[model samples]
Target: MQRTTISVSGMACDGCEQNVETAVETLDGVNRVEADHTADTVEVVRADDVADDDLHAAIERAGYDVSA
Candidate 1:
């Protein structure tokens, strides 16, 4: 598994955190996701071949901003 730290913006509360976590964790290559509302960061464990664009789009669609 490959680990990556992504900066995510616009998480207002725990619910938003859950939503972001769910979105990231749902990806095919994602093995785990820990999204912190206060930190505005998401740590992910992913299988090889998953691109950063996939991660960015997933978070954006879930109503957040991702820092590339």
Candidate 2:
């Protein structure tokens, strides 16, 4: 498994955190997801084959910005 920490913007509460987690958890190979609105970060534990772009896209689709 690979763990990735992604910086994200626009998360303001636990609901935003949950939105991000739910989004990322839907991707194939994603084993776990944790989002911290206060930290503006999301940590994902996923299979090595999972692309970072997919993670970014998932967060974006859920209505947030993924930082580079």
Candidate 3:
């Protein structure tokens, strides 16, 4: 498995965190996801085949910005 921590923006509350988590968890290779609005970060544990671009896209689709 691969663990990745991504910086994110526009998460204002727990619901926003859940939104990001839910979005990323939908990815095929994603094993787990934890999003923290307070820190503006999202941590993902996923299969090695999961690409960073996919994660970023998922978060973006959830109405957030993934920081590089």
Candidate 4:
């Protein structure tokens, strides 16, 4: 498994964090997801086949801004 952490904008509460986490967890290679609105960050534990872009897109699709 690979762990990736990325900063995100627009998360204001625990529900926002769950939204991001749920979105990322839907990806095929994602093993786990943890999003913290208080910290404005999302951490994903995924399989080797998961690409960074996939994570970015998943977060964005959930309506958050991801830092590069």
Candidate 5:
């Protein structure tokens, strides 16, 4: 598993946190995700094949921001 951290924004509450997490979780090879609203970031465990751009796009689509 590959451990990754992506800074995020627009998470104003726990519900928004879940929304961000769910977006990351849906990607193939994503084993786990922990979204922190206070920190405005997320930790992800995924396969080596997971693309960073895809993840960022997903988070944006879910109504959040993913740092490039």
Candidate 6:
């Protein structure tokens, strides 16, 4: 599995964190997702085939912004 850490904006509470986690977990080959509102980041454990664009899109779909 490959681990990726991406910063997410607009995560102001636990609910937002859960939203980010749920969104990322929906992707194929995503093994795990841990989102931290406090840290404003999402850590994804997924297969190598997972694309960065997919991750960014998932975060956006969750109503959050991905920081570059």
Taking all chains together, each candidate's TM-score versus the true structure is 0.93, 0.98, 0.98, 0.95, 0.93, 0.97
Write down the worst ten-residue block by lDDT for model 1: 23-32
Task: Please estimate how well model 4 matches the true structure, expressed as its whole-model Cα lDDT.
Answer: 0.92
What residue pairs are clashing in model 3? none
The deviation in Å at residue 31 for candidate 4 is 0.8
Better of 1 and 6 by TM-score: 6
Please list all clashing residue pairs in model 1, or write none if there are none. none
lDDT of 6 by residue, 1-68 (tens): 89999999999999999888999999999999999999988999999999999999999998999999
lDDT of each: 0.90, 0.96, 0.96, 0.92, 0.88, 0.93
**Candidate 3 wrongly placed segments (more than 4 Å):** none
Give the root-mean-square deviation of each candidate in angstroms: 0.9, 0.4, 0.4, 0.6, 0.9, 0.5
| Model 1, residue 6: C-alpha shift (Å) | 0.4
lDDT for model 3 comes to: 0.96
Give lDDT tens digits, candidate 3, residues 1-68: 99899999999999999999999999998999999999999999999999999999999999999998
Off by more than 4 A, model 6: none
Scored against the true structure, residue 25 in model 3 reaches a CA lDDT of 93
Q: Supply candidate 2's per-residue lDDT for 20.
A: 94
Overall local distance difference test of candidate 1: 0.90
Q: Worst lDDT window (10 residues) for model 5? A: 59-68
TM-score (C-alpha) between model 2 and the true structure: 0.98
The TM-score between candidate 4 and the true structure equals 0.95
